[model samples]
Target: MKKSSFILMSMLLVFTMFVAGCGKSENNNASGETPKTETETPKESEAPKKDVSLRVFSTFGGTDTAREAFQAALDEFTSKNPNIKVENDTMSANDDGFRTKVNTDMTSGNEPDLLFYFVGADAKGFVDAGKVVPLNDILDSDSTWKSGFSPAALENVRQKDGNIYAVPLTGFYEGLFVNKKIFEDNKLELPTDWDKMKTAVQTLSKKGIIPLAAPFDQSHYVIEHFILSAAGSKGHNSGLADGIDPNWEKGYAAMKELYDLGAFPKDAATIDLGMASNYYGEGKAAMILEGSWAMGNWKDPAVLDNTTVIPFPAMPGGVGTGKDVIGGFGSGFYLSKSTFDNADKKDAAIALLKHMTSPAVIEKIALANGGTPAAAGVEIKGKTQTATEGFAMVANADSVNNPIDTMVAPETFSTLRAGVQAVVTGKKTPADVLKEAKDIEDANKK
Candidate 1:
């Protein structure tokens, strides 16, 4: 099948996205600082061997599947560069505080030497604020490192200004994970479309099994898929700058429709993502909304054996095709501006970034977490069946969209999330929620 590039990605093959490729800017001087000349340039090969400590912050800690692989990569870097010490500062991506901590540190002048975060809207603030240095020159200067990345991976991460700020390691795709065994036992069909999905939810819920294991607070995946399922790719990427799409309301309405039918866990109102995932991992939930990175976290052999992924079905009143997916090269590591200018640490930070994102390390992390490796021709080995099938799903998608959060203001996305409970419980209409979210989006642009 010919894989179409989604809003922010132009994927090459299976399990990837085709983000809209923006024209690369002609000028390379947008980043505030001037490039270092040959003599003063920091190269991994020319770094002086001396004691230097660097802190790197990311979402690679706690129960993250890539935690050990990431640390091992760092350990290898630190071992080779014995003079450099790396403080592995990390937070779980599931936590509400993850973005808050990153923003706080970036704005407070306490930015880490290396930051692993989202590539788009989330990084826009810091990137525009000049907290991080654009790596275009550095990447160009090193032919070996520059050639290691897939051209599309690098291109999709380019900021609106046409400069590449974040260096990508892996891309990702999100899907609806179905437990085949449960469906079989209940004599139900896979939720390939809205009617089938509702049937499964009603059947599973009647049998006392959670139809969909999702939390209200960290409803990232839920919101993403629902919106994509309702609005389709073009509408999903059509940020609120123009106006709210009517299909957007249908997304929320579909969520309420599922909620009224007992799709979510009873304690979903208060449980966090971890708890919701725990329910799915323990085999108490028949289905879940998660990304490829979740493959390692679901430990039950039975669950793993029965697992398969599909794009969330389009809702009844929405324009989305059931084949649309949510995914892309969403995030990567950034070299802090402060670190780049510090002569003592410049070489160390750049070297570490190079080493961490090297093709070999990218393969390892991708294997561990089921992320699509960003390095061209770097094949991931021993991926689970679910992961492999998810690749096929992405390759077959009508449109693979970036998460709605990336397209909208953070506050606007937050408002949409906040309205889920209110909408599901009959306290608010879907139109009201969309209006409130659109208002917030408009205000944020001011």
Candidate 2:
């Protein structure tokens, strides 16, 4: 959406939401509309229910925290509308294969009725192909539903075309998650700055503890935090369409510096994000660079009890304030164009979409995942200490940014990710790797 339009919409929602006291009437339909029961009578017996089946693809699988809550939401919708049967299709999205699968399915004409995916360049393929419907008219048709969303959240997901094709559930933020108990036990100070971080890395590695639990292959968080902290918001957000920023070189250099300090696992190149997370969760590592959605997945009570998130400390000569963060409403639900055009599935799909993105469901999912709720005035109760610290970190941050992957083409990003191992292992200089990535970016633009 245009900047002016986003601002105007934000102002309108803020006024209306304040008038509504940041909440809607209780017992309303999942879509935020009050039930029409006062005027309509039961007619279940008058006609057979038109049965409809929907497939919802999301990342709420394995230890995603929101898995159970999402399934419960599906169950509730099924019970309320017996005619609609929802297949809760889910997958762990900690690896590149998930994106491959999503792209393949979307391109193969096997798109789900409702797909939960990223918002920016990651979505450009199916979006440009017209495989999904822009949700502007749909959201406008239902003021209650649109009103339930925070304007900023919707604004974050709006495409460059000045249209919204996705309805967000919960937003997220990423930072360095520390195991406080481990630090205390080792008589080490928390790595709130570069000096302290280096001390922790050296000391922890000497003690045979993983200083930073990160995988070289699935290094999304590592790449994101390092670049944002080193390059600051402006340089980081500057897409490769122009050229390489020198600060970006500093980011990779910092990663190499960490590698020399034994900051990564011995098998970092082989492990995936899950195993990296496992090392941190099992208290085998002092810290892990991760996102808010990852907080609830750690089952170790000791680790969970002592964990706190901090922005990756700013590096020497870097312009970042040491408080710049990475995150926002990065992902959301999209209604498939085929589903909308299907006369037999249109209403059912829309109803299911509304029910899933409802404030009530968003709240439940946020409570479970500790993500920033997209629904206006919806508060998360029973948030863990880690989540509380995360919120405070974001609230005090100088800037919040989306991850770098969202700004560039998929293949270009893949090249960047593939560069991490080579950069750290001395096989490639940061400049060389970035030049290769820039070449790929240039080709993609053509």
Report the C-alpha lDDT of model 2 over 1-446, residue by residue, as the tens digit: 89999999999998998768535555355567856556887666676778899999998887788899999999999999998889988888775677988999999999999999999999998999999999999999999999999999999999989999989999999999999988998999888889999999999999999999999988888888888888899988886866898988999999999999999999999999999999999999999999998877799898999999999999997887799999899999999999999998999999989988999999999999999999999976437888988988988999999999899998988888899999999999999999999999898878
Per-residue error for 395 in candidate 1, Å, reads: 1.4
Superposition error at 339 for model 1 (Å): 1.0
Error of 2 at 384 (Å): 1.3
Instruction: Summarize candidate 1's per-residue lDDT along 245-356 as a digit string, tens digits.
Output: 8887888888999999999999999999889888999999999999998878988999999999998988887889999998889999999999999999999899899999
Query: lDDT of candidate 2?
Result: 0.91
lDDT of 2 at 5: 98
Query: lDDT score of model 1?
Result: 0.88
Model 1, residue 427: C-alpha shift (Å): 1.2
